[model samples]
Target: MDGLMPPPARPRPAFTDEELRTLVRPDRVHRSLYTDPGIFDLEMERLFGRAWIFVGHASQVPNPHDYITTRIGREPVIMTRDAKGAIHVLSNRCAHRGVSVCATDSGNTRHFKCPYHGWTYRSDGTLASLPQRRSYPHDRAEIESWMSLARAARVDEYRGFVFASLTEEGPDLETYLNGIRHSIDDLVDRAPDGEVAFVGGCSRYIIRANWKLQIDNGVDLHHATYTHVSTLDDDGRQFSRHGGGPRIMVDGKKSIDWEPFGVVGFPYGHGYQGRPPVETLPSGPVYEEYVRRLEARHGVDRTRQILNYDRFNSVIWPSMTFQAFGQHIRVVRPISVDRTEINVFPVALKGAPEAYNTGAIRSLAATHSAASMIQTDDIEVFERAQAGLQSGAHDWVLFAGHPGSEEPWHEGGWRGQGTSEFVSRIQYAENWISFLCGGNGNERG
Candidate 1:
């Protein structure tokens, strides 16, 4: 039996051209995108289905027979290192009786034994053994081709991060990643040893808001000063009331002005916010050392550009978001129209001083953790936004901040200054195209 199912009929267009144009004003977005279950389902099929959604890292399954299970879109997938050292991504369902082959989050096993029955499979997803050999008259050859575990249509890895797509056709991983590849490069390049390991346990939390809201907020720098004020205040520093006034610094230097940070929006929904280093100690020493090492390998000016580069958050089109300095990676898993599960992982510099990873974990936990003062406030606000969207008072929200104002494209894409919602606008633009065109043609705006 073919496992592929026909694409479901398209739902009524969630927003018309005029309505979407109004919804995503230069500075705001429509409220319906957050509350509408119909739009959310379309997103899973169009955006999530085509995008290179992050699977677990290769280091998570370093040894042969080691497996890590994760979700891609709504499908449960198993990523494993086979005896040949090749990584395979396959559906977790058993071919024999449609039972799940593996149930644990992760583990090492020579073969997968289906819990419902005695059917077993090798680490490579091939049929290994069944309970009775002669139960069926026409057995081994016929069963072999039919019983292998179902595999993802395509699987690819970049810088140790694994990704799988449900569709067999589309842009390859690199093309699809577009300009966002720099984020991955920066992640490894910043490591003293030019490599990173997935270290520390994952920190996960459920947010009661649409997944896109979380993504938009990740690149929204305007909130740092206001929403995160309590966090900074807890450290005994006060933000300047005046825009340019002197303020207490985390590292005894000038505080970041927030306005200088720029936002870049890419072709797909991918984008990033540029941030100057918070006046701090460790950055100078660590960055200088990293640059010197990079200079030795790639020479001077190039090393300067790579090491001294500033980026606040690097967001992948649909799910993953990276903060290279903080060594933080967040995976957004949409559970429903208004519910999202976010998993945060810390990257360890393979051969660098332990203090680097420790400091990163500490800072990440302090800022983004469930107990974080800043994150808690942001969560409450997002939840309130969701609740408000349920009201019929407003048909749309607006994204028109700084209308007709967008920066020129530099290397990867166009950049927008801080306080601009260009990032949010670009995201909705992509959403409009993907859903309306079914991941094909351009969207009419």
Candidate 2:
């Protein structure tokens, strides 16, 4: 939970009703939100500063002294496992002369020693040692207090995924996750052992577009058929020219309708686009036996709910999106006004047959890897959009694919037609609310 203290009230620039309306036109968003450095700074301060952004999974640092360094908004932080087996999210900076404590991406370390000043901190972030004890006796307390790596305001875990809030006051992670909690559950539940762990290596890419562009792209199902045409072309012998051939079947029934992939938009800017089932999944006695075992363990209805749930990709607000069934998570980090860093993590389903986990990994690489043919093209499109927006030719981008087509709001959130941009709309709505209400509004459902 965020516990940030409120700043004294100042005469801030009131984003008037007209400006808010103009910024989030049903069909388009204002260009300033994407291209303005001032707006980008405010977003980092307001949105990322207050939201529960996913840092890394706890399994990534399973060992007692294992640690992983990552960004929480613009701040560099480390997720380290203490000797007592608890994880702490602390600033990577050293108290003595503000140098980074850990330089490598990740590894097992007994303690973090500042390369600059030889100050050391235990993996749990307490000051362990200083080079000279007698240098300043009375200042030892001040030095030690400063030497302890600054921890995050709050750190929490959902399933095994770790999230840290930069601020000191806000809703708990569960309250923020709302309807999207099911996505994480569905991912872990698919594992025969009811657990999932990061696998393979992470893929990192730099995109020359605003971070929101990447978020919008995740829920845009219609682009796949066009932008990823090369992937479909490569598999033309099996899939039809339009990227549709036959429905993948499981248990003598069609698994997904290729024509319509649904989208579900929840409060707090979380949402997902349903992914069509893979037609290439090997079917036969092996598949049947696996299904039978699952049915026996979870019952017919529960097993059906697990396997037949339509969503393929889910976006957790502000940052982090993953293809649950595909076993991959993407962390989006805003580098600047028009620059972003995206990290992709492949996951292995624990207790599932090795073959099944391998299949999921292969599928993730084929579709979402940094060097993926499909993903490369998608990045190019985003870059082109960024380039075009800079030319002053367009002032807004439309998100009104399904205007007047909102689904009845339910306990699970709003459902929409497969091709709709309602997910993006919902995200921007929450984004505006977060910026306007200072992280305390009742915008979360």
Candidate 3:
């Protein structure tokens, strides 16, 4: 009676780390990873909770009092630049009634006041006042804690990009980026002054598929050869028939029957496809003008490196997608197990000619926008993949497409053909497994 055996320990969790390990295999992944509602909630806790999630770029809130509302996992938050030019990410909920403190899509505001109650907070999220303060007990420490907006555990900026962590500890932004940072650097470096700016507006589309499918497909070129084949014009069709459309290659080798693309993979599922031959991009009225500016600022050789250097799609695992070639960026937001929202932002190179920026914008319009000639068809394929995955006809989605390559690490991380399962496999190994197990990122495949 004294010990009572403590009735054994109660298992607080409904699932365990062992169960999540079962969701992945060497060359295949279980379908539940795409369709399970419970798993989605767990990911919100584990994946988004611990990772350094991309909140917004510094340009989004450039001026004092400028702010934009967004979410980290399911937590509603606001990213605001204060009068002193420091950026802060504060929970959007009012401390009193749990109502949104600021409700417009985005704008400049000196302070936030809850509509439900009179609680007010400064731009830095410090509580200014609340109605009838005399009615409450004056415990200074307790009141200070309650009045202040809850902030993210950690916030850091890299190259004007801002990221926040819900958990207190993790690698800083630079470490999380690793090889993938080069893709972002190159994107802004292509600008004549070594900088780029968002064009102030973005196109958004609702994708009816899992968010993972969209990110994986962002770095995937094989699907474009099939899914967007219909959008090809007569000349475009001819080019496709000869295997000369959009492509991802490494070491000049991208043949289905041949060795796969030479790509780079890094920790946290971030990587880039082979650099495209941007030098061969069709010359235009503005092409010569853009080249002159680049050469003027960076010299001929550096400009050549910039022009010929092409990264088709640089994927930042979980959601963000960067494309150096298109001068466009994508942020994928997961709404549910089957729904994802993709925001596409068109960017411009600073100190470059007007014609150059306009051409890149036009190129994006024709191929990547909502009104894009090809994406409508591609969206259908994404939905179809979702429908098929939900059928449960196959327990695993196969990534076994690479021809013949070594299974071990290549150049520090696992890498192989453009279609190699190694990319996804290592993502699961280095990032997913460690994330699911709540480890310190030391776990390896």
Candidate 4:
């Protein structure tokens, strides 16, 4: 009888709103936030459900009837451009039998035909037809209405980047992106044509860690000195074909002074790190030609300002993080409490020299690809942290370094020294808590 019995299912802990608030402390967060399935479920519903999550870029679906499959939280959705040249985010599930209609990652398709039932829907989510029309004894109008795919409540775009919210209520796209819009502008302005494209496709890898780990590392300037030390060469420079990344060591031994550069946090869990204290831009004929194209469009002074490269990874919280200089955008897709999928898409600056864009695409292979030395190092740390968090040895994860040192920054943000963990602190204390509590976070901590 004992051998025939199934193992008992583990009970999931549910927390009240007040209890959720207590999980996020001033300088640390409860370890359960990283390891609990119940907390992850609540986050998927309350936080990601109402937030304006990035779907994809307009450049990805440039033509009519083109679609790309992506996710908003745990729900699978399709980002499609209809024949009328309008974009829509539709639930991937079929109205009948709850089957996923579209299975491919991306392609040009006029209709999404559910393979199992032979029910088809147009790119705009309108029901086209079904195989068993005679079998349906229901009302004609109700059948049509019920058969079509459901759409995101609201969809909007800013400078070609598309974002969708599952719930109709909440701030507009511009309001949600207020403090972080400049980073998008900074990326777009780098192109001579004032546009950027997702040309290099995507490099995706799964990490056995929580999605928040990727976000925490996005603006943390202190970890590179140790976490990725192996990637540094004899001169302490990170391996890059273009040359010039943050020099972590003086003579491959002592760490460089990080006081000059800084980290900054904005409202809604957004943040960026100031450019490394090294010359990071590429040079040579390709870069010179790229500069010439930019100068031709905006003149020398504006071109210099456009290429200033003031910041590094800019994170638009809970979903996306990108680099204007690195020419790539990283999307964080959470699978579960201890699993995440990261999609790295290399960006191509429009109207820039072909060689310049080629270099950017090639650079991604050595830095962000699944087997890249740098990214693998970070993944290892994330997995290790996840394993350690499961131990129940520690109750909290600290972000207390450089306390009270974040000064007032531009556009109602805060700036701190490069090593300051204030960025993560603000995320947990302000935006993360507010979102979990169902508020549009701009709370002062």
Candidate 5:
């Protein structure tokens, strides 16, 4: 009697179209959207499964046979460079029995051999060999075709940033990027060589909150006044390792007029905040030399435009965010309903002075790294939000700040005041629901 197996657990019913639509409204979102595991699973399927997700920078796999393993939603993937210099995003799972073939983060490996059965695949995702090949009745080509690592349905790059889609249909990478490509240009244009490399190894941290919480805070401007008040000096200026940044005082002390700086939101939940007016611009010999090199390639006027620190954190929603001026990239990886892992990679401008790149890497240590002041503060708030949303005390999470204050922005997006929540509102109202309703969720794009 003790050996009796328990009845199989019942599967939760899927959300209907109306239910999904109701979860996200124009001004607010239902609390259950954050606390429900079913919603997260659907997001991994509908949103990430169909949207163009960021894979990795092409610079990460520049050399032939170079491969880096990352995730596309819940699926493990390997971004590799073949002998022909073609980049491919291959599924990390082995074809036979679905064991992961690559375990390390990155390396130059010609073949990924499965540890379980010794089945190997080329960098291009072609099957190379397998143990006991003679046991199979099929010919070599058939076996190869069946057992090779599956490649992503589509892969493309924009300004060296690689993006992959699991489904073959939908818009191309360029079409999907919309105006966000300009933000990438802002980063690469600063590079004297017209290229940027993801240098210093990634700094990773886990947050006990829904992945959206991290992204929601990306373009948020008002949070700094209260949430990051601890990092501010007595004068209310936010201090980093290098020096002071914008001031964020909770009290009615001296504060920057952020509304004029502006925050813009684009299609597909992409957005960026205009760079807050800093206390001081980058100066000194290194910065001068950096500007001189930039001017030499492009004329003085062009260099000045390129060097203008206009955008702050450019968010490629649901996957990545980065700062062109700050010289770092943040890749968001969702682990589960209430867990997310963020990887911060410092960017090095190719052909720039070594000291400039090193300073960029060091600067991230004080702002975006795992132990950084700004990031830790944000993570705590995210966890607290997650804990609060778990209860049934509230039915909706508000995003109604500064309503009707937005203006038409470049490339058909909306620009709101610095303190507005328009970005998150559009994300939930338009894009999020479109995906959960089984569409591309790219009407605006």
Candidate 6:
């Protein structure tokens, strides 16, 4: 029995909300924010407790009582479609004794029966059955009120993507999205039917780094020239002379920087970087076919304009990032101070050519898959970052990419050259730090 149990763990002292404020400052953050377990626990309470988190798509659980289990911050929860076709997010633990109710990863069932006590719950998280009617003197109504599975504070869908927030209060999804909802719209707008679905399941991988590191990388175009050089696989010919500038593509022996390569770091810590179009995808037949369909819906000139705008990587802070041009989305889950998990889903555009979707899936496989050398290089750095930070060699990480050069974005937010730390500052320092430090979520500190 002694060998069956692990050693006792040390208790982490609680930090007052005011104390949490001191760890964050504009321009830099303490290394303990990434390396300390106590701070990690605080993040779960203050940050994850309040922010909306990305769950699986509705398509993933389309059937009655179909469900997938995932976490909100650190709480295990279930996202399921009930018999009535309504989606629900329910705590995975049993109400009776807090035992895990859903043991399997995903499946369809008429009802969830707790393995510990057989207290069953309906898909809507209503109590369905009790082992014995007379186990207690309390009426069934009283039992239901006390024992039904706990539900998420809110569940909402935008453009077929589902999200859940456990905290009862915050900005609604539309307001929280602000301008970045356009990113989701852009993905749906491309389809002739004006919809998208998650078709090619998902790839889940664990990384030994803080989730924020990956979030920072999602919009940091400055790193691509050096960190993802292997992905380009040229003599650096396609890279513009200036770092973070538009990327050039190799044509035979010559390289030319393509048009419309740009990035913008927006309010609510969201932003996008330009990537080649779905039209530029290498899957010959489908690319042309899908374009023809899009052209028919929107005129040729309009189709071309639509396809070229902000179609690359878009980061929705604290939860997920999307690559519309690539037709996949990445959702990050923080597991611990030094561990994170990411789920990548290849999206299928409704009413589009199968070839187009196939091409998107293939592209995702080549770049972000677990075996992808391009992403493997990134993982190496994420791990080394954790290791280095834990070594106590330095007290802070600096984000000084473009000093005193940030400009107001034409619409809103800030615009900087692709190399700037605008995204990092906005996400970690300005927007998210303000949330963690108790400034208004809707305003800058």
TM-score of each prediction: 0.85, 0.86, 0.88, 0.94, 0.95, 0.88
lDDT scores in order:
0.72, 0.75, 0.71, 0.86, 0.86, 0.74
**Largest TM-score belongs to which candidate?**
5
True-vs-predicted CA distance for residue 2, candidate 5, Å = 44
What TM-score number comes out for model 6?
Answer: 0.88
In terms of lDDT, the poorest run of 10 residues in model 6 is 1-10
Superposed Cα deviation of residue 227, candidate 5 (Å): 0.9
Q: Write the per-residue lDDT of candidate 3 for residues 104-208, one digit (tens) a residue.
A: 767899889888878888888888887888887877677777777778777898777788877766677778877788788888888888878777477788878
What digit string (tens of lDDT, one per residue) describes model 2 on residues 300-383? 888778776467778987799887766788999999889999999888877666766666666655566667766788899989
Give candidate 1 regions above 4 Å deviation.
Answer: 1-29, 133-142, 234-257, 281-304, 440-445
Per-residue error (Å), model 4, residue 253: 3.7
What value does the lDDT take at residue 397 in candidate 2?
A: 75
lDDT of 4 by residue, 1-445 (tens): 0010111212433877799988998999999989999888878876777788899999999999999999988878999999999998998888888799988999999999998888999999988998888898878787777788888888999889999887777789888887788889999999999999999879998999999999999998778888889988777887766786668887757577775688888877788988876656688988899999999999999999999978988999879999988889999999999999999998999999888888888888789888988899999999999999988777999999899998998866888998899888878898888877767666666
Q: Candidate 6: misplaced stretches above 4 Å?
A: 1-13, 235-261, 276-283, 309-311, 438-440
Q: Residues 187-232, candidate 5, lDDT per residue (tens digit)?
A: 9989999999998999999999999999998888778777888888
Better of 1 and 5 by lDDT: 5
Q: Comparing 1 and 6 by TM-score, which wins?
A: 6
lDDT tens digits, residues 181-205, model 1? Answer: 8888888877657778887878888
lDDT of 1 at 150: 76
| lDDT per residue as tens, model 6, 148-263 | 88887778889888888766677887777777787888887878678888888788778899988888788765565556655553433322211232343443332442223556
